[model samples]
Target: MSKPLVSVVVISYNHEAFIKQTLDSLLSQKTDFEYEVVVGEDKSTDDTLAICKSYGDKINLIFSEENVGMIPNFIRTLKAAKGKYIAVCEGDDYWIDPLKLQKQVDFLEANPNYTICWTDYSIVNDKGELTKTDFGYTKDIIDIDFNNLFTPYSTYTLTSMFRMEAFDLELYQTLKHYKDNSLYVLLLREGKGAFLNFVSSVYRVHEGGVYSLTSNYHKNYSSYLNIKEIMEAVPESRSKNMKRILNSLGNATAFGLLKQKQKGEVLTEDQLKFMTDYFKNGNLKTKLKYFKRRFLK
Candidate 1:
């Protein structure tokens, strides 16, 4: 077959119940340009590999004999991509709009300044029941640069499509913690991002979901680590924005610890120090809040 214009990477591990739907959603995409679906089945303990194999020659299947974990599988699968544009659809999530890829590719083709494009998405429960719609944003459209990319307003990985050239695979392989947020930062550093108003995918929240199923503490701590990694990965020229992103993440981490303290959990000295460190360079309001939380009964 001729080379595809776009490559879709679907990473699966023990997603036996959901792999079929994920592959189906991807395969069902109606695009004028050619696109390839690359499935990386990370030696799932369940029937995910079998389900992926059932697709046969329809997708470029990469199945491992042993589990390689999420990040490694992601990197290797990405390395296998042979297209100018790259898109991702996790095993649990599925795209709703058949024209999702076409719309995103068209936008990227027209907008040379933007390196990445993502649409709004819906949230669905395990049973595939729609829990919420018009998720991510209410804006008609928005531009995402490095500064705002660290904010709450951001791209959903499964709904995103980005230029292959924008991705730094070497740098990505070096990251200690690999998450979608970090990947977005790496890509945005090359160019800006765009948020299309339409909902094109469904983000599944299930018991097995890595992020959704974690405790608040783990989630908050993970967020802290994610930002820290991004800060370190950014070059010195972008240090100004990195500082801002650090302050934002630090404040959020402190508040997360405070919530845990209020829940009858004692804050460790290390936790308190980490929280206070974030405020040392912060303003008076932030320092006072930290003091009140730290010293006040």
Candidate 2:
């Protein structure tokens, strides 16, 4: 068959409970451009593939015999993408606004220099209900400058879109599991990106889901290291003051590790230095102010 208009890659592994909602959400998009749904069912023991097959001509699916995990499966599914631009919506996540795809497409078409775009997302309970959590990541939308990307923000893959060339093979090989942040960094490093501001998707938080179990404080440190490493690889990135931003992140993580006794997680000299140098270089007044609020009675 001829190339499809848009490639919407959806990764699923044992998301049988929520896959239907995700599919329905994609089928309801209000874009003027044509699009195809590419499903990578990564060895789900559940009925995820069976459900996908039920859609037949309406959707395209790829079922694997072995689980390739999140990053590998995501990269694998993109091989089938026939659209000039690729959009992503994970298995458990669903888009709330039907105009989500249309908005992103319009922005990319109008701005050729920008290769990436994303909107804000809201958190939802397991029963498909919105939570008290925030829907906007004002930190990112306000300014997507390189420094902004380094700082922690509300950005998530469910609300983001990237052009096909967002990552090169060399970069992808270097960054394996941290695909989400890697893609964000690559786009920010190369071209301008837009923050749609509108809350276009619902990021579901099941009691048994990912964010609920993963330690946020721990992940932040590792992510900071990855960003530092990538910056070092890109010579032009030095102009963005990437090193200072990473140093600040290390300082923040040092305090975080101190609170949880995670300094033990510092396995090597590099990890130890990341914590110590930041601590030694930390501003005295700032440190004192922090201790006053945190320790003083």
Best candidate per TM-score, number? 1
Query: What does candidate 1 score on TM?
Result: 0.89
lDDT of 1 by residue, 271-290 (tens): 87876676786688888987
Tens digits of per-residue lDDT for model 2, 1-297: 467556889998888999999999998998777888899888888888898889998888887778887777877788877888888888999998999898888878888888888888888875667863354455534446465664446567888777877656467667633637667767777788777788888888876465545676667676677666767666556645566666556666776755544334534575557556766667885477456645683
Candidate 2 lDDT score relative to the true structure: 0.74
**TM-score, cand. 2 vs. native:** 0.80
Candidate 1 clashing pairs, residues 3+ apart or interchain: none
Question: What lDDT, from 0 to 1, does candidate 1 have?
Answer: 0.83
Each prediction's RMSD over C-alphas, in Å, is 2.7, 4.3
RMSD of 1: 2.7
Per-model clash counts, in order, read: 0, 0
Best by lDDT: 1
